[model samples]
Structures are given as structure tokens and as C-alpha cells.
Target: MARHHTVRALLVGGPMYDSLYDRLPAFERATGLHVDVVDRLPHPELNARVKREFESGAADFDLISTHTKYAPSQATWLSPLDAELGAEIDDFLPQPRELSRIDGALLQVPRYLDVRLLYYRRDLLGGSSVTVPRTWDALIEAATTLTRPGIYGFLFPGRDSGLFGTFYELLVSAGGHLFDANLRPAFDDAAGVWAADRLAELHDRRGLTPRELPAWHYDEVSASFRRGEAAMVCDWPGSHHLYKARATCDVADRVGLALLPSGPAGIRAAYSGCHSFAIPRTARNRAGAVELLRDLTSTAAQLGEARRGAIPVRASALAQIRAEAAADPAEAHRWELLTRTQEAMIIPPRFAAYPECEDAIWHAVQRAMTGVVSPQAAVREGAQHIVALLARERLSPQPNTV
Candidate 1:
């Protein structure tokens, strides 16, 4: 095969990930192989575009940014990396490494681990009697009491995968499962209703969130909290650096971190996964793509991102961060809370049609939160739609790989 000097890639772009791309120049300078970023959109848009390209047989990019939850759907078009990257894979943290594979084949390089934590304004909570809210009811009470003229009580992503993920964690925390023994939809039960009701109460019944929340995604929710417009938010680790940056955040010094509050069943579940990079089977510059993948996921690269608040997947990078955290009280508390919360992390079921299922659920959830329907009715409708979708796609529940 002729060696190609340029590699094209489709990447997920945002404030949280833009810093990593800033280092691409170093890679290009060292290897003399240019990287062309074909497209850079958020996760949902990137997923849709990649699906369209793959289905139309027009996937010309050599590499793409992907997440563990969406990898199963794209596995057919991704090239297996076991033989070429096995040694590098061995150094990754075990859970992230497991999430980077599909059906026992290493298909991607793990970049960072993502899990949601409750981020609040320490100034707001400290003066109040609310003591870090250990349960959902307690959180609601705190949020209600904290609501003021300019500040809303709570904030969360209201659409797309973010909304679906929020609902998933709440459902699991309530002692519910997404699927039962036969892989059927099991979220329409009482637990599901309870989860949906909480979201409804926050948005519609009590008006604790912004009026435009139904259209907001992860970025919007994070921005709202950074502006000090909300007292609390459930957000991912990727936003940690921004939350602490005095330049971008109004309440930077007042920020506080805590594990997610427990549900009625006493479970504190967090939606979690790893963001990664993969080579497509149709990649024109396979060698360059592989080399770029290795460079992007190297310990040095991961350490840079980790210092900026992302959870590194490489064991060495993680160790370095832990040592650094030991000396900083704030960093030490954040790291300890995140590590303990990992025990309650939950990932979506592995299946090719999972994205479609997520859409069905989030739409129903949006309807509930907007008062188009009751929580019970929304859960029932969402479950029915998922069952129909699974049948249409002829998909069976695949066992979890991690």
C-alpha cells in the first residue's frame, strides 16, 4: 500500500474538547503528516453525520471521535485495532479499556472517562441549612429554598442524549432497569414514573429551571450554571476546569462538587462512559490514522487533558494526577468524590439501535417536562415506542461488554 502523508478526521468539537486539538500541531510537526479535520460538531450532530456517511458509503475520513455508548452502532464500519495498538491498550485503566472494545475486538483508543457529579455554589449552600443534599427529595427541598429573584434552583440538559442519560441514571437510581431478562423495555414501571415526575416537578410544577430548558443541551445547562443563574446542576467531569476558571465563571470560587443524590431506593447511579478515537474500515490513510491515534492517546496527551479537568484513562496519567491531587485540598476532594462515585456508574445497553431508542425516550421525557403529558403517560408512551423501534430494527439485547 502506498503511504499517505495526510489523514482526514471527523471530530466532536466543543469547549471541553477543543484544548486537545490545540496540541495537534505538535503531532504534525513531529511526524510531517498533516491532519485535516473534515468536520467538527457536537456529539449528537457528529453521530448523525457519521451515520449518514457510513450508510451512504461515503466515509472518507481516516479517524473519528466516538463514545463508548455509541460504538456498538458504528462497529460495522470501524477497523479493529487489537494487533496494532494492543501494547498501548494494556496501559489504559481497565474499565475504560473494556469500554473501548466491542465483541472482544479493540476498535478504539480510550481518551477520557466521563461521569456526572452534582456541582453547586458553595456560597449558596453554605449560608443555607441545606447540607449537601444526600437524597433526591432533599435536593429538591434545597433547590426550592435556594431559588431567588435571579437564580433558579437547578439546571440539567433538557434534550437529546443528555436528557436521555439524565433519565437513565435517575431510573437506575430508583431501582429500575432499562431492560428486563428478555431485553424488553422495563422503564414504564413505577420507578420510571417516579423518575419522570421528579424532572417534571423541577421544570413545570415548581419552575425551578429556566423557561427555555426544553431546548437546552449539555452546553446550555453548563453555561447557565457558569453564569450563576442556577444554584445547582448535574454535569459531567469535562466541564470541571471551566467551572473553576475565574475568567469564564462568575461563581468560580464558590463552586463545590458532590456525588449525585440518592433516589428513593437509596441508589446513587451516575451515567458514565469513555470518549475515544477510532479508525474507520474505509480510511484512505490507515498508517497515518493509526499513528495519530497513538499520539492523541499518549500519556503525555492524556496528562494535559487531565490537568484541565478531564478524567484521564491511561493508568500512568491517572497516577500522576492522583499524586498532584494529594497536595491540593480542592483537587483532592474532587478526585476522592469522583472515584467513590465510580462505584455507582451505569452505562447504556450495548446495541446497534440504542441511539434510536435514546431518541424515543428523550422525546417522551421532553413532552412530560413541558406539560404535554403526565409522567406516567410519558413513560408508557416512551416504552411503547422503544418496543416498536426494537422490533422494526430486528435487534436483540446484547450483553454488556464492560
Candidate 2:
């Protein structure tokens, strides 16, 4: 029989945590372990606080819920779960598993997956003779097709980081590279210029939305699209569930999800992100924390999470999802979209300075979106900032072997 443990965790307070809280009681009852969840700050602020805690030698967190991409850099501050939970690591979905590893030792185990999809209005596309886009050019044209007096063609979050993250998939898909193998900035080349120009043109030429929409984050972008003010928008899967609920949006039935178009690289990349469970080195009960992680990642817990609208991180949970979809059509559609986009999802390079890079890139993109700077200038500045950050922090390209 597996050993039981009483664990403490500091979880980010948000919709995601609510889902975990709903499932925790059962896991606790089964394992004879108690879970104490503390809601800290928002995503960005929580990350900052974690850093401050580590720097000040006041690390009080046991298990920290965080993104997978930063696991490698954070490995020093995190304990290895691989030795304690090898079998559990093997059960994770490929993408989530890859994201969890840092120098062959898993620093984080994904609790959920975040994948992007194109959200569109079924009424507009079905009623009109306009065909949905299958390519970049076609996407722009379709945006025009859906644009009317009040309704805009596209509804993406235009803020620096929000829009930039989504746009990277397009840039990479379009044969534009952000960072080279040496971990150097490479977004100043010909392909980079073309990609940025096209993104900016969506606002300047094609009628997208709000004019100030670039300043909007996920919530505002999703709210605008769900309320039927925008025709097509690219967003995380969470939007799909929100729009489909009866109490959520009026256009739930009229909403349709599509696979984003493939770019010049012939690779259809979807901007993907994941949230994982990690144990900080400062945990008072490291052994107990790993046990809790093991239970949270079990097949049953993952399936429960999937049913609650988050993507399952375990491969076995997919079967559970398939069975549940057999009973619900809406869930079936959502699952179909996720399965199709699964391979196309892209994980950002895992680096200790990734958060800094992400924040810088987000700021640059926001500046461009708000017209404070040109897209070309924004990319150039972003590249410079990224390179300078690497130098300032002395980040290495590969995992430390010594």
C-alpha cells in the first residue's frame, strides 16, 4: 500500500484553484492525507513573490503551482520529484511531461494544459458565403468578411505579453524564429519583419476591434468576443467553456472553434502553456509533498480535472475524457479541438530568465499595440532587451551539467 502524507501547498488563487479545491477533498479522503491550500497572489505577482521569498531565504512554500517552462531555471530552488515519483511522471501527457522535466529531473508535474484555438461565430460563417480561413492570407480575408458596422473581424488580446505570446506561434509558423539554438534573439530577420508587419496590419488595415483592444488582456478580449461584438478571436480553451455555458454568454450555441492556420514553416504551431505542481526546496515536509503530488497526478484526479473544463495532464485521462464526451456533445467538440491541436502546441524554451524575457516581450508588444512604438521598433527593442537580459543574468543556453 502507498504511504499517506499530510501536505501544505500555496496555490494561485483563481478559477484554476477552484477546480483543484473541488477535487482535493476526495484525494485527501482516499490517501488519508490532509491538504491545506493557501491562495496567494495573481499569476504575475505570485511569481514575483516566489522569487522574493527565495532571495530573502524565507521560502515557506511547500508545493508551488507554476508554469512548466521555467522549471529548469528554478530547479535549484525545487526538489526532484522523479526519484520519488518515477511511475507518476511517465503517465503524464507528452507535452506536459516534456514541460515538467528540468535536466532530466522533473521539477514540475503539470496539473492542466493550456492550448489556443480560433473562436468564431457560427451564425456569421454559416449564413454568409464567406469561407473560414485555412491560411494566414485567408485568415486576414475572413476577418474582413466578418467585419461589419458594429462587429469587428478579429478579437485577440492586444496587450504586450498577451498578444505577443499568441503572435509567436504565427511568427514561428511563418518561418520567423524568436531565439536561436544558442539562446540568442533572432527576431530581427526578414521573416520576423514580415510577421510583425502582418500582425500590425490586422489593426491598421483590417478592421479588428476596440482600437484600444491591444491594451486588453485575456478577460476583456474573451468578454468582447463572447458578447458577440467580435466575429473571430484566438484564445485559450477556457473561453470555449465560458461561451458554451447557458449562464455565461448568449451566443454559446452560435460559437464554433477552428484549428488555426499553418504558416510558411509548414508547421501549424499553437501557442501552448501549462500549469504544474512543484515542491519548493523550502518545504517543511518534502516527502509528504511528493506523496500529495503523486495522488494529485493519478489517473482519477486528472480525469476529474478534465471534467471540470481543464485539459488532463495524464495520458490515461484521455480515455476518461473520450468516455465523458460520448455523453455530452459540447464536451465532444471541445475535446476534438484539443486533440487536433495537441501536436501543434509549442512550449517556450525553458530558461531561468524566461519570466524576464516574457515580461519584456509582453511590454514591447503592448507598446506596439497601443501605438506608443512601431511594431518594427518593438521587435527590435524586444530583441535587444532579451539579449541584454541574458547577459545581465548570465543565463546559459543548456542545462548545467557540472
Candidate 3:
């Protein structure tokens, strides 16, 4: 017999989590455990809030909507779920399946995955006879040839976190990492310089992005791409529906999806992350929280989310998404996007102090992008700051999931 509990959940709100929020009532009814959800914030903000709320006092949340990378850092805040998750490992796709554990403790049950994809305007590019780019240099060439008075070639966020993610993607694709085995900053070398220089040339030299690239948010980038102001964008998969829906997008009909182009490293590093549900160690309703996690990740729930534009965490849901091709070719194509992106997936490093290191690098990226410092100088300075940070704290690199 299974124990039931009334659980309080803190969920990250946004389109990515909409289906889960919408389906909570049914989940409560099915399990007879009331789930009281706190307000949802944007992804990064929600994680920040969770950390704040958890640290302010005793655990206020029994269950939470979190990311796979976060579980490693906050392992103490989360209860081990290995005994609860027996034999369920085979249900998930590779990324989530491998990331669910922290120090060998099953701490999170993944809900959905996020990966970078190449979103482009098929109409414009096809007219130029430009096929999808398979490499970064090719992408740059296409962007250069495609840029004009108003229509830019590439659109990506330029704010701090966005900009950092940008450099991180390039660094990974160029065979570099934020930190090496000894927990020292490793992104200041050749790859970092080239990445910064390329970005500088695109925005300042050739004008491939918005004039106010530094001020742009992710939403603005998506909007520009959706409005056909940009020929292509390297971004997350959420834009697939937005670009395909004629009612919301001007270029919906001409949109084309492709894998993120390979970088100088000769591999397509799939920049990725996932949203997951986790129970707190101090939860008052442990049993109910576990059940809620199970139900939210169920096939029906995942399918509902998939239809609403989220990648399912489970293998069965992925199969169900593939089945959509029989009824609607467009929907099927979307599923195929998920499949292709999964193959090139690259997860960020996980550790309690990873955010601090990320912020330091972000500041450096900003300085380089804004011409406050050359890319080479920015990364060199950033690496120095990181060494100091490492000295102040005992940080260690965790093993990669892949």
C-alpha cells in the first residue's frame, strides 16, 4: 500500500511549465493528495528564489520544479529518491536519465529537456541556395552573405546570462570548458579568443545582430526572428511552435529547423538543461510529493505538455510524439527536432559554486562584447578572477553525465 501526503510545490512558471500547472488539479484528484503550488517565476529566477526560500528557514516546499544541474549543488536540500525510483531509469531519454542523480542519489525526476537548435527562415535562405550549415564557419559565412539593411543574419540574446551561455556554447563546441579537472578556469585560451573575436566581428564589424545587441533579452531575439527580421538564430527548441504558428508569426510558413552547427571543435555540442521535480529532505508530505512527481511525469501528462511545446522526459512520451507524424506532419517534424538535438546534447557542469564562476565569465564576455576589453584580454582577466574565486572556496568538478 502506498502512503499519501498533501504536498506544497514550488514550480517554475512559464510556457515550459504551463501544462504541468494546468494539470495539477487532475493530479490531486487522481492521488487524493492536495498540491498547493506557489507562484512560478522565470527559469533562472525561480531557481534563485528556491535557493533563497530553502535557505531562509526550514523547508517551505515539499516538492519543487528545478533543473537537473541544480540537484548536484543543493543535494542537502533534496532527499534521496533512489529507493523511490527503482527500475524507472529506463523510462527517460539519455540526458534526463543520466542527470537525475547527484552523488549517486536519485534527487530529481525530470519533466522536460531544453536544447539548442538552429532556427532559420527557409524562404530567404532557399532563395540564396544556402543549405543548412553544418559548421560554425559556414554559419558565419551564411550570416555575412544574408545580412542586409534591415534583416540581420543571426539573432541571440546579449544580456549577461544569455551572453555567457553564448560564449559557453562556443567554448564547448570549440573543445573547451569553463573549468578543468583541477577546478581552474579553462576558457581563456585559443577557443575563447576566437569566440569573442567572431562575436565582435558579427555585431560590431558586420552588424549581424541588433544594433542594441547588449540590451536585447531572449524574448526580443525570439520576436526579431519570428518577425523575419533575422535570417537565422541559434536557440532553444521552444521557438518551433512560435515559428510554425501562422497566427503568431509572420515567417511561420517559411521557418526551417536544423541542428546547431558544429564549431571548430568538430562536434555539435548540444547546449542543454532540463526541468525536474524534486522532494525536499524536510518535506512534511514525502509520500505525496513522490506520487505527484510520478504523476506529473506520466505519459498522459507528458503528451499534453508535448502538444503544448515541451520535450517529454520519458522514452514512451517521445515515441508518442513521434506517432504524431501520422496525423500532422508539422507536429511530427517538431518531434524530429527533439530527436536530432538529443543526439548532440552537451550539459553544463554541476556544482554548488558553478553559478559564481559563470557570473565571473559573463562579466568578462560582456566586457569583450561591448569592447571594454578585447576578447583575449577579457577571458584572460576572467580566468584570473576565477583562480582567485577557486582559492577562496574548495570547489571540485563533478563527473559528466554523458
Off by over 4 Å in 3: 1-6, 32-34, 129-131, 148-150, 215-217, 326-338
Ranking the candidates on lDDT from highest down gives 1, 3, 2
Q: Candidate 2 or 3, higher lDDT? A: 3
Cα lDDT of model 3 by residue, 69-118, tens digit = 76776777989887887887678876577788777677888888888778
**Model 1 reaches what TM-score against the true structure?**
0.97
For residue 288, what is the lDDT in candidate 2?
71
Backbone collisions counted per model: 0, 4, 1
Query: Over the stretch 1-402, how does candidate 2's per-residue lDDT look in tens digits?
Result: 222355767776654445556767876787677777755554666677778778889777668878776556567898877788766567776657766777667788887788878888888874548666777767777787778877888877776456777668777887877788888988777666656666766776564667877667677777888778888887775445577775767688888878887777677888777777899877887877877777766788777767766787787897778887978887787778788997787667777888788787777766665556787897888889998889877664433212
TM-score of each: 0.97, 0.87, 0.88
**Among all candidates shown, the one with the greatest TM-score:** 1
In model 2, which regions exceed 4 Å deviation? 1-7, 27-34, 148-150, 204-207, 264-266, 326-334, 397-402
The local lDDT score (0 to 100) that residue 381 gets in candidate 1 is 95
TM-score of 2: 0.87
lDDT against the true structure, each candidate: 0.89, 0.73, 0.77
**Maximum-lDDT candidate:** 1
